[model samples]
Target: MTASQDTIGQICKLLEPFNSTGKVLTPDTEISTDLNIDSVAVMDFVMEVEDHFDIEIPLNVVSETHSINDLAMVVDARTKKA
Candidate 1:
């Protein structure tokens, strides 16, 4: 699969359990408030994302991620660098 498709799949997998009630997330979607995800859940989500992408997400970057789009952009940028 291509990088963007792979990224979207990984995001869907990480977010499926939380947004199981048919919540659709666009590229500009907010994660915390929109998805009702707490800080701890975000941490876990970040770890899952890292594992899924086989890349280490920096703590600083994690701190800056306020939404699914933010996180996906970070991952996408990292993947591109790789």
Candidate 2:
């Protein structure tokens, strides 16, 4: 798999703990609705993702992200720039 694909996989794994329903997550899964993540949880999740990817995500961009694919895209872009 490509680097982005690998990163996406890692991201999905990271989200597993937050998925209370134990449902399978996909890239298209909505972060808020599908994952049942609240605003508070979103902040914590973002922090963990930043730490995992070794990159800082801008707050504005974080707010705009809506799905797993959106986050993976942001993470991929940030990591590539680094």
Candidate 3:
């Protein structure tokens, strides 16, 4: 799979326990609204993503990420750089 696809899959796995809707997560899924992720949860999720991907995502960039695809793009770019 492509890096973006892999990132999305890993992100979906990280979000599974916190996603109350039990809906399948996709790249288009909104991180906050669709996933019902609160601020604290977002931070926790971000940390997990950082650790798993071995990259530090800036808080400003995190705030700008609306959907899973956006996050995946950032991860994909960072991973490529590393």
Please give the CA lDDT of all the candidate structures: 0.75, 0.85, 0.85
Stretches off by above 4 angstroms in model 2 are: 1-3
44 Cα displacement, candidate 1 (Å): 0.1
RMSD after Cα superposition, model 2: 2.4
Query: Judged by lDDT against the true structure, how good is candidate 1?
Result: 0.75
lDDT of 1 by residue, 1-82 (tens): 1237567667977887766447787665677777778878777878888888788897788888776667877889888888
* Per-residue lDDT of candidate 3, residues 1-82 (tens digit): 3346777888888878778888788888898898788988887888889999899998998999888888888899998999
Task: Supply candidate 1's per-residue lDDT for 13.
Answer: 73
Per-residue alpha-carbon lDDT of candidate 2 for residues 17-42, written as tens digits (9 for 90 to 100): 78887778888888888877898888
Clashing residue pairs in candidate 3 are: none
Model 1, residue 2: displacement in angstroms? Answer: 15
| Candidate ranking (TM-score, best to worst) | 2, 3, 1
